[model samples]
Target: MARQPVARQTVARQVVASPVLVGRDEFLALAGRRLEDAATGRGHLLFVAGEAGIGKTRLVTSISRRAERLEFAVLRAAAFPGDAEATGGVLLDLAGDLRRAADAGWRDVGHALSARLRDPLAAQGDPHRQRRLLVQDLADLLCDLDPGRLLLVVLEDLHWADQLSLEVIGRVAVRLPGRATLMIGAYRSDELFPRTAMRQVRGRLLSQRVAEEIRLPRLTAAQTATLAGAVLGRRPTGSEVAAIHGRSDGIPLHVEELLAASGVPDTLADAVLVRARALDPGVRDIAAAAAVIGRSFDFDLLTAVAQDAPETVDRCLRELQSVYLVQAGADAATFDFRHALIRDALYADIALPRRRQLHERVARVAVERGYRDEFVSAHFDEAHLPGPAYWHALLAAREAAAASSHREALPLYRRAVRNLPDGSSPDFHATLLAALGAEAAAVDENAAAAEAYEEA
Candidate 1:
């Protein structure tokens, strides 16, 4: 067989910059024009939304840099995960910058936060007064700092915004048109649902006509190829480019991982496996289990698989979330892989025994939870252990039959038959053959489903 050509090894780190702006020249140009308009005293509120890693932050950073050249006063705030010391962390950060711009005279802002707001309620004079005071303080600071110039206030990752921050942001959105302010807020669209803080803030902004939302779509295949070339410093081969696009679903961060892992010895899968192996053992183990269970595993399941104490698992989970390696589900107490490539790399690194042990645990837990036999069988098949493999195939066939997917089930039964011991009963062989024949006959061979079944 002919060897595949190596992807051009550019001496560059994969560009996983925030707001990874790629192939959206027209959109970016339009955004720049809006910022320019805002800088020229025609301020507008622009809300940018997309899935995580779609480049919202990168786009905003680019705009901020351009706004700087235009002489607009730029202020920024980023939301934090939990109860960090800084309650209004974003506001405090912006206030710090504003104070600096004002020759550090408004040091009172920092003093009030550090001294008076020692408790979450103390900052406001009381809990009920907190929201109103925060808004007033922010508005006052903005008005004070810029006196007459256009101001751009960007709040990134508002999906994690505290209630106080969201309320304050809503107020700012309502009040921006009258002021020389252009406030841009960016968040993950998949995370926006009714009744959540983000959704509520968005609703308030829309009702006030103070916000214009821009939904950032994934990069096109050509754009992705171009981005890969730019990052790699040379064009990728057709197959390598396709692999990057397909695996990343056009998400820039994922595309970077796929491209960066391309030239390592072994297949892409092996490369992922190798990288995964280099992680700390605890993280690596949890990551492997996450991959096997597929995206979005329950905390309870992780606990069972890792077989660690509750506190240990909790600490590990926090570490994962902190690094953006995993994200919590919006509605459920579940965690999902941060990126598809992470899962791919993890599974590639998993050894047979470890995979089998984890899968066995999965099979037991899933069965106890009343999950379908097919899911359980998938775990068993992935386990690749001896006695369980045959049982898994039978169960797979049974479940697939009920779902009208016998065409998909035929291969499992055939594999089971081939793997049966030499002393197996004649009746077992006949039963397996019969199941395969029936499955083959039920579907038209020309159909795509049939083709997949045939290949399997």
Candidate 2:
């Protein structure tokens, strides 16, 4: 399930009204032309990708207003967390928009869409078969919005859409038949990680030329200053622009928030926190545990450290993925946060005692899996388990030296020396010093090599 949408709004209320669109003249013009083409029976799917707060919504809104002015029936909906047929009900929502329009063709199209999508239990057979039937039903209804008539369907926050919704939407995008309907979706570009469902679909669309996506980058420094000036109703001073630009990192939403509050507003983490807190308790707890493992983690390690069944962890992770908090990584077995900011926020939100416990668990699991000694050593050290920490430090140093990474080995060797467990044998200490001396010499630090030899 996707997260609950804020509230459904009419197309006019949802996107007809937007503030100035900065840094998008060329795309806006291109979209204007696309609208003309769409109205004339050549229609296609379009997409917008950007980081959160980078003005994706604003860009879509600008296009939606133009689409409306050209007599295109504008319909807007967002994918959110909940049962698709219950809370979100995006298909039904669109149907409602159609009914409100009350045109003969549109009203019939709306009724057909509602009949197929509004019920989760009625006439339920094979889920796969039902989904196929729904796709066919949706495709058949497209002509009602085509040829002499047109519709612009704007779907936002697609990064939060569930798998079933994604599949249905993709099929709809593909089967439009170059008629008079344009389907445009907005998703966080950061959500497009390797092997993730969204990434796979996006890649397929682009590769097959089934859709065209516009990626919106952060505002340039000059553009950021311009935006600040507009919000301020006067030109911002050099220092004011610099401060806002630096802190906002050129994300338009951050810029708007900074200008609105005239300060940093305490923490942008608030938004992350609010979303995290709204998650199911079990999922939220797992997210915190994942954070303890850092911004990037694999499914196996997370499952082991999370102490849950693999299927359970996968379910929770899917929920996390749908919300754009964590994304699938280079392969299906790996995952990472959409941004370091998200990971840092979750990590900081964990209590210190719980954090230590998770670190200890992570170290234990890593050791069982024979993970890199440096990784194991860091976690053990964080858990304050000096005995194990010292042991892995020595192992890490030896491994680094074997890999011919003497510079990295030096610190590992020093860490081992500093954290040596009590009651160590004299010969053991001497051997450690000799190994350190060799690595130090390998790096051409003759002075340090002599000091280690003398210690030995």
Candidate 3:
């Protein structure tokens, strides 16, 4: 018995809210202009690459909207995760558009495809064969029904695309000459490492010189501030602007998250911390470790703190990169938390005991390596141990002060003052008082300097 066809919803709903169109004006202009040119028979190919959540989709959406206004036909497809659709899936998507445009019911198209491909079940074959026939049908239909209409095809998240889809795209790329066609693809460069299938497709595209690649760099400080202001509906104070820029490092997605988290009364740091606490445990841990280690961290250090097998850590890192919580470094040897705010958020998420343990390990590693005393002291301050911990921490602060890193020394001195046992020796008290005075003087805080001297 022939089964009934499952009803499928074809409505195209907008998933993104009002996006604050930050940065990337130049790139957007170039893409828009090229697409416009393509509609006039100057066909070109564009490849937009960036890290995940770096606004590739948003940019492309803007271009697509503009193209529609200019009367150009736009076709879009996105790759899926595991259970990736084969090449036929992309072809099927293209074919559906062709069928719709012809005003020919799918049934008629299916009959035509089955007759053309010489398959009895051409209308109801497995998705793969259906896709193959669909593509063939689509190409023929395009030629038959409006061959002169400009068509702009966009494939997004190509990193997740299946091998067959990539091959299909390669075939389309080779056949684009003299046709009213422009193909645009977007993918995350960090995840598309050498030797992968995606990389192979990229290599073919390059060798053909049919693709023009545009790599989006991180946002500038001014651009970040402008974006934050737009998101918040007000100008950011100097401190707030600096805080967001420092932490977010100009990633549009991070900037948006930070603004949403900041709310009306809370500062940027507080907002970042709040958001960080809400992430999944694995992401939060990786973020925290990255923050403690600074902008970039070694994988070995992360594994040491997480106490997980290498593969487990690698998996977590990849997840972090996927959501833009972290980024892999250029050489692929190090990983970085995208923004300082993310790091702070992650740091605040961990259990106190685990944080202390991680800090202790970091401190021990620094001490064993004869690293700068100040760096070691910073870890001790983080560890929050007692007795000898306090003394070693104090020594680290003094070293920092000697190195003229008064800002770094200030927290250490403050911690020592707060944690020192009561009724301590006068000499120890006097030394701390003097160190605090010196730190204040270095920062030109005369009033605080005088107060420290008075305490001494």
Candidate 4:
């Protein structure tokens, strides 16, 4: 048999830079121009897709922002995961004015289809008729609303959208031509499967020559570094930037989360686990023990946590390093997990009860190392011993609030509440509830705050 040569992998070049929009200029310009053309009554429907963290939402936001500057009327709606079967969700979001217009009998089609639009179930028995009715009604509504201004409709997370929502989008897209409208939809291409309703809807629109697609690729290493600079307010060291890029794989959300972390973070733990599962049993054990110790630990500490002989731990470390899972840190005595996500994956793989025991052991080690109250509290909380965790959780919540990290404060407040024994500290419990409500309100989770206040 003839031997086939292995193709070499392409390595991305590292480019140092000051802060800039990393990898989306061309796409943004194209979208901006399309919206401008729509202002001239040349409507267009553009589809953007990528993986979850690939910056689809950011791109949509950027285009919408630019459209607003150009005097375009932009309307936005996002489909929720649980509402994947919701009918008219996006339509209702964009057509709030339609209800009033229908009530006033401003247009014949709007008045005729108002009942169907309001009650999706009423028209469910006849999908073909309902689709037609909606298509005409929407076209008429847009025509009536036209006041020599472009209308930009943005639908995000289309993979989570229901069948009727997708159909309505497709129908609207087909009718958008020669009208002052531009429709843009963003979906997670990775999550969308063949033969699914969303795919069918997209296919139908594309076949009609009514929609075009733009797929967002992962950022290059240089682009990743540029993004990091924007977050850090200064350029990161080359190695630090490379570490982030390696871990994030150029995913925007992953990069941002890693930048936001005050310590080694496990933001991408679930994604990293897919690759971490390849480790051998012994090496995996060493990795898990090292994770419990911390993201960075000395060889002696690893040996202590793993309870393995120095030589055995050495062998496992060498094996792990060979797989690019761990690397020598500041010196030979110490090493670091290649990414916090890898540590998280290894730690998460441990069974729950054993995990709690490991967390307890970690808490003891943290105490010996003179770690901060919050660090120790987290371990104790994980160990299912909430006594020590309660007071520390409140202290941590105060620290987070003082820093104006209100989103971060909410979890600490939640932890404080969860660890408190019912009726044992009624006054303290009320205080925690009040703090929780305040933090929740600051984060725009008003409903959650209302519920918390109601409970209090």
TM-score for all predictions? 0.54, 0.53, 0.49, 0.51
User: Which lDDT value does model 2 have at 13?
Assistant: 10
Question: Is 3 or 4 the stronger prediction by TM-score?
Answer: 4
Please report the candidate that would top lDDT against the real structure: 2
Q: lDDT value for candidate 1?
A: 0.62
Error of 1 at 212 (Å): 1.0
lDDT per residue (tens digit) for residues 68-116 in model 4 = 9988776665564423323444555345434444335334434444454
Residue by residue across 24-76, what tens digits does model 1's lDDT show? 67667877878767666666778889987687877887888878887776777
lDDT of 4: 0.69
Local accuracy by lDDT, each model: 0.62, 0.72, 0.64, 0.69
Worst 10 residues of 4 by lDDT: 9-18
TM-score of 2: 0.53
Per-candidate clash tally:
3, 4, 1, 0
**For model 3, the run of ten residues with the poorest summed lDDT:** 9-18
Candidate 2 residues 153-256, lDDT tens each?
88876765544455567777776646788888888888655433456667888898888989888888899888877776688888888887887889876676
Model 4, C-alpha of 286: deviation from truth (Å): 36
